[model samples]
Target: MHSQQQGWAEQQDALAEFGQFALSCIDLDLILQRACELVARGLQTPIAKIMQTIPESDELLIRAAVGLPRDIATTGVTKVPGGHGSAAGYTLVEGEPIVSHIPTETRFQVSEVVRRADVVVSANVVIGATGEAFGTLEVDSLAERTFTQADISFLQNYANLLAAALDRHKAHRERVANAEERSILLRELQHRTQNDLAIITSMLRMEARRAKRSETRRRLESVGHRVEALSLVYRRLYVTGVTDAVNLSAYLDELVKRRFLMHGLEHDDAVKLDLHLTPVEVDHSQAVAVGLIVNELVTNCLKYAFPLRQGTVTVTLERVEPGKARLTVADDGIGMPDDQVRGHGIGLELTPVLAKMASGDFTLEQRDAGTAGHLVFYIPDLRGGGSKPL
Candidate 1:
């Protein structure tokens, strides 16, 4: 009775050790090896092995083993027929534990690994999960031995642990593969969108060149620039392969550079840009709104801010406080007179509405140097599905 109790305690300890390791690990072969190692110690046996059924075949391969020859255990070429002949095959066929004296066994044949290792006794149980039989885990002893009912029960439970670990590892692998596939598809779609936007911008530029009146030409050209600005956002998304958020700092920098290139202006143009920006990450929805507002403010300044002499348009985006940010576009040129709209009035009028879309407010005033527009907004929470402005 005392020996039986001690054996049960050892089994419990073995299960606990293997269970913790299995839960935290994702490697199937490593789990199997550890399971074999633990069961042998739990049962006070000299050798243990785990055989896995070959896919769509009636053959069990020696997937992992302990206390066995290096050639037979690690080479993965040892195969046991999945029939009533060998101990592993019999347990797999009958879906039951086996206690056998292999030296004088008549009910089943002896496998080569066991025969060569001089194994005389073995205890085996089927490894299975939810009507799926995976394989068998067996503990073998070189000396003559008799396995009790407690030994059989412990082996069965240990095999069940192996089956559960295999299922979990398979699920994790599938999730990783699925995420990679989705990322690839998203990048391809974004690439196609960039191509289409470029085509549209080209068409708009053609129409602008064909216009007769200066005002009509300028309006068409502004439309083209707007499309080009939006294209930069998508281009960034495609390059980064991240659709959930946008790096606002990089996008704005690119936008400013494109504007400089569009007007055929050098670094020392009559209206130069002085950008004071900080890194900011916002969700896609917030990024689009901010991008449009910045484009409009900068375009207005370039067209109407520096009319008399050389001046600089300063653009700034800074995190003012937690959950709040400010974007300022100021110029050192002629200030607005009597709250008059600057560039065609459309951009300035739409500015307030765009700011609202981003959960922000827009304000324009005559500063000491030139007209300054301020957009102050609450950053969205982006953590744990809260609004994220992180």
Candidate 2:
């Protein structure tokens, strides 16, 4: 009874020491090393060791040890035997405490490791979130000494603590991996953007040099307007830290102002642009479509919407219903006949194909009082859902 009580007291003291050390602001490796040393001293044993299981090889490896050669203390790679296995292996397989008054002959251990030791017993405790066996708490004494139930229970609690630490280390590694992948993707996007910019710059140079008259030069300047619009989209995509939806209103305002400036149209010019648009969110595919459509419409308006001197162009865009939009490009200028309208711009034909691919409706209508074009189009939600008529 006295021995049992004394052992209990020692166990409590050891547990308290471990708790204090765990709470201390120390390195993780240092804390684990200290725990192994303390276990040997508290138990009055010749050897005390902590072993961790390697995931890939399914072998037990000693992480820290005391009262052994430096090389022996660091080595604990033990594989399961084809026949019967050691106490440590049995402890892990059965999830039960195993105690034996027998010597463990291991190829992983050197002769000098346990020369002064008589019987070396180990208590295996399952560690980690899924309760898989992680390692063992082993101790050896010069004389044969049976470990009590209380000793096994104390070691089990420590094993749980070690399991939590191992999980934290795993999580840290996953975060680092994710960060590296994101960096690689960002580099690839930048390379693609650079290539696209080079192509646009070449096209603008070629077009500018080929213009023969003031009217031709003014028409070619619209290409610069379109390129600047694309550049703005890319810039905002990077600046806002998003590759998704852009503020349509802001983009259009900036785009129109730049186009007017490129054609030498001052801010207080006779030409007035009235823009009325509802809020809309679009993915890259839709954004690209809308950008090209705007370029074509704006180019036509600048060329023939006004009598090169003065006029008003009202552009109204609205989401009439879910996945349905109505766009009207109207100008108080010389009206066009139905036959002339069909051959207005070749790009208008692509609108119907793109709309069909999106599972939407596309219609072109000519309004009276001006050469007005109404684009009634239904665009399916980029995310999901059926298309709606515009």
Candidate 3:
């Protein structure tokens, strides 16, 4: 009686240990091997192994095993045909546990490895959460033994734990795949939107050339330029393959160079361009507002700053502090008249509105030989969490 009580106590301890293994966050293979090891020790078995079904195939492949020959454990014995021919295969197809005393059992052909290893008794149970079986867990003993219902129940419980783990892993993989798919779709949508904007800009340019009156032509041209500026932002986004933030240095360089080429000033010997920019990243909305403001300021300088188009325009962007950045566009030419400086030209009128949209301050001042436009704004740390101005 005392010996039976001691055996019962040991089984309880093994049950607790096995429960911990089931809840562990270890990799699937390691978990399976560890579970097999625990079960072998608990049941006093000489060998334990797990076999998984190959998807779309009628084969049971050994995945993890304990107390088995290295060659058989690693290379895995020949794939067991999925049916009632082998104990593991039968359990998988029937979705039920099987116990056999090899000496007396003739229902299934025993594996050559089991015969060679002198395995006299074996038990196998299906392993999976859903109704369909994924594999089977098995334990074998060298001496002929009768596996009671209680022993079979213990193996079934272990298989159930393994099934739950497989289910959780499948769910995690699906979630990750879905997120990646969504990102690709968003990028494609942004690319198409950029292409559409380019089409509209081209149409507007054609309309401007057909306008009869000089004022009407100028208005159309101005509107077209604004659209072109907006289109450039999306172009950069598509080119860089970055949907979240714009690299300000590269963006401004491209923007200014394009403007120079458009205004027929790229080859003008009288006009010189200088850019002193620092690398910074900003959200899409802020970048668009900044680009538009730059468009207006640079256009104003080309038209009015230099009376004979014979001076230099300098654009600079730099970090002012941890949470601030400043952009300056300065030119050496005839300064704006004090009265006209306050007037509502499209360039001047739009500058302040765009600056406000960008959460920035806009200012214009007369320099020694021309006019200077300055815009200071809060820039967020794009690397960290959402906008924390830095």
On lDDT, the candidate that comes out on top is 1
Superposition error at 47 for model 2 (Å): 24
Ranking by TM-score: 1, 3, 2
Q: Mind giving the per-residue lDDT tens digits that candidate 1 earns over 198-226?
A: 99999989998999999999888888877
**lDDT of each residue in 228-339, candidate 3, tens digit only:** 8888888877766677788877788888888887888875568999999998888888999999988888887777777787888899999999888999998888877665
Score every model by TM-score. 0.88, 0.52, 0.72
In candidate 3, clashing pairs total 0
Q: Which stretches of candidate 2 lie over 4 Å from their true place?
A: 1-124, 128-195, 213-228, 336-340, 354-360, 375-390
> Candidate 2, clashing residue pairs?
none
Poorly placed runs, candidate 1 (over 4 Å): 1-6, 75-77, 336-344, 378-390
Off by over 4 Å in 3: 1-50, 54-58, 61-79, 92-128, 132-169, 337-340, 384-390
Instruction: For each candidate in the order shown, give its overall lDDT on alpha carbons.
Output: 0.82, 0.60, 0.79
lDDT of 2 by residue, 199-242 (tens): 78568757777977866665455556556566666665555544
Better of 1 and 3 by TM-score: 1
Candidate closer to the true structure by TM-score (higher is better), 2 or 3? 3
lDDT of 3 at 301: 79
